[model samples]
Target: MHALATITLALAAVVAAQKVGNLVPEQHPQLSWQKCRISSNGTTSCSTIDAEVVLDAEWRWLRNANSISNCYTGNQWDVAQCNTTASCTSTCALEGADAQSYRDGYGITTTGGNTLSQKFVTHAAFSFNVNSRVFLLEPGETNRYQTFVLMGSELAFDVELSSVECAINSALYFVAMEPDGGMARYPTNEAGASVVTQFGEDNVKQFFIQDGKRIETPAASYPGFPDTSGLSLDYCKSLPTNFQDAEYFAQVGGYARHNEALRRPMILTMSISNDHWANNLWLDSTFPPDRAGLPGAERGPCPSWGNGPAPQEVERYYPNAKVAWSNIRFGPIGTTV
Candidate 1:
């Protein structure tokens, strides 16, 4: 095994809301990240950052490598001048342009429907303030597909990139994961059919961290945001009648499930307001659970009138930091709001 040193692009360490108690600095602070400072201009956020990613692949030429002058000048002539200078018409190291010459390549999708693309490793300081109120890729509780693999736990929720853009950037610098990691996954079956309707009571306890030591304040209580002290990551059946109209919300009794096939841990942040008329912040003690089996399996019989079986309470992360929620949504993927 040999180690090749390469530097092609500038990098980042997004540090916008890096406050005191909201972060777990002692165990997982900035190590080797590219600096990224992204904010808003008006209603839209046009932020940019230079990031370097490390490529951990075998011998192959990159598209960006073509711009390198030294490697080309030295190797091109020797490749073209094989024997006859009069017949030398190429600038590469081999004959028969298409047969033995190198060409750029892309990753192939496997039989399992998963594509093996660029792999991004996050080992640096990173931060961002997205345009939406909830930092979710989708509007409601629904299932979506993500290409990254997430590992580690708690203060070390590290994310490893495996996409084309990530691979190209990985060739440049070392990148670390943000505290919450990347995308959330919805659990699936053998045929890839969504199991959203499969929630029940028996499995509600499996998704939560009840007795574990408190990591930090719930990310929902980040200063100006509402309080979310007792909500748990487990399955929730109902919502307060007063909290009925929060924009971009999951309605009570709505069928939702997570796409767990990606195997990435998600840090879902939510904001609750007391004023039923407008969005006001209020912390709820109970939260939803991961529905894994037949839809409505654990929910028992349906309610006669309102919605859901009944109202209940659960534990959740409080004291919001970068108040963000999982990318999971309600309804099918690609469906419009």
Candidate 2:
């Protein structure tokens, strides 16, 4: 995996209300990570850093700052508290996520020292938490997020996805983001990365799985491309994914666009979400199911009814779906391995 040495992406999102962030004694969950240095002679040294995880503002409780009434409830804004964005921003405040809140309210937790886990579906205090997005905070700082610059580096981490199954996505990636969480540009965005996005078409899509089987091999690999473990503009340009929204990543310069962005510091984000948009066929199934006969259309091993179940079906069938990422180590290209 390519090492990400930066973190910064602004996710423009549409929430039930535009409220001020996590105000009530914000408590971020603790997670351990590290930065390593590799000498020319192959000497390696690593220093573990203490970090914290903050829940995205959307999942935090939004209540009237002066009272017990919730500003937003049951998928709707309590108009009495917030009839407009200004009203909502002024009247409601997003609450903090303690470790308990992370686990009970959002189904997120840090255990075994560094591993962070996200559950696809869980019963929360108000409703079901269908998905979650969390961010990493800088060490020794309460709210400032950590950043990395990953241009000539390699980022390595162990992922537990035996339970992640189909239609559900658990992700970890970097984006050029504001260290202060965009609070300066958008005051109402008291929370950082309220809605995050980056210039990439595929994240975990390179991993081809088919019911415990990885079908794609080097016979169809890009010229001079030794393996599927890595990607290049050549591979993206020539590979036939039959993406449901086949924009041809190479046409837009693909990772090239992102590589330029990486020149600056960027923020890291982790999340687990169900794709209601296209039933997540883009990840593990033949995205445009009709194009299954296409050479590279088949993506993963799970049975595909257009690539597994839709969001609703996944919620019902795999209520316990979860993913754990840990032992994250970053440094020179080969040092991490």
Candidate 3:
């Protein structure tokens, strides 16, 4: 009787475990959404989506070349050879009018200190595209903008002030190409107001928290809050002195341009840093025609603009700026599971 009872209990325990799903910890669980409660209004909604871990390995350096056929064998300072498409040559050049000039004066390395494993470097001058997919709940819904919220933090090491330039700009930004080949940029204010106004482009979207105060994009309109414009410059005067020293995190919550979602593969370009010829100058004097001439140009400095250029850009020009980041993550905002 004792043996039979023990066997019966073991079978019951197995059934219980099956009912509760797998008890072991998950390694890279599939990304999904679940319903969660909204604290503000006590309404149940799906706003917090699970994110994927893209760059989590320790000391994982950003790849200098995109080519899978031919590896970059040159010195650390030499320009990397990239083959972006399967049909392109091993040294395939970017397809743009200014591609030649844009590819010059840049290099990448992964043998540096201060990263997850003390090795991190920026890709060459061209954009390093981090690709990802956006989820769609249903089909047959075209023209609906798919909104994504990117959240992560990064730290800079060995940041140095430029000896020749008054200001330098480093930025991590998102670029989505339109069906017609036009591109829309996020966190557009990376160049600050003087540059944006001088170039005649709309102030891009960005949000930051510094010194316990929230700084919003200048003269920008968000999706849910259509009637409200962004915060003014006066509110962001008291910024931190050393932006590189802190672990800065940004949350850009908004819909895509022209209702275009990232359902298709999109590129997240990290223009680590760019040192301009002078303070408040755009990194490149001649803005690309495709990027310039945006609407709603505002004439003022951005509150979130760092005092120094991004550490990555600083490394590019001075080779002294050291920057590293934890893995970056992206996903939908309203997912609850």
> Global CA lDDT of candidate 1, please?
0.19
- Model 2 lDDT at residue 17: 29
After superposition on all C-alphas, the RMSD of every candidate to the true structure, in Å, is: 24.0, 6.8, 19.7
User: Compared to the true structure, candidate 1 yields what TM-score?
Assistant: 0.18
Residue-wise C-alpha lDDT for candidate 1, range 1-337, written one tens digit per residue: 0011111111001111111111111110001211112234323121222111122111112111222222123124333223333222122111011111111111111111111122111111321111111111111112121112222111111122222110011111112222222111111110010111112222211122224442333333223333443223322222322233232324432323222322343322212111221111111111122332322222222122122211111001111111111112221111201
Model 1 spans with C-alpha error above 4 angstroms: 1-242, 246-256, 259-337
Per-residue CA lDDT of candidate 3, range 1-337, in tens?
0000001112122222111111111121112222233466655344433321111111112122243222222323124433332322223211111212122212222222211111123244543412111212111222111232222111111222233232334443344422111111211111000001000012123344445465554443422223434222221221112211122221232233312233343333233333333323344332222333332122233322334355445445544333323223332232221
Error of 2 at 277 (Å): 0.8
Tens-digit per-residue lDDT, 107-206, candidate 2: 8888977989999888966666789888787887654678877666657666788888778888888756677665455553544331111223232112
Mark the 10 consecutive residues where model 2 has the least summed lDDT.
1-10
Per-candidate TM-score against the hidden true structure = 0.18, 0.77, 0.29
Candidate 3's C-alpha lDDT? Answer: 0.25
Stretches of candidate 2 above 4 Å error? 1-24, 40-42, 66-83, 124-127, 187-219, 222-229, 239-256, 306-308
Provide the lDDT at 201 for model 2.
Answer: 29
**Candidate whose TM-score is highest:** 2
The models' CA-based lDDT, in order, is 0.19, 0.65, 0.25
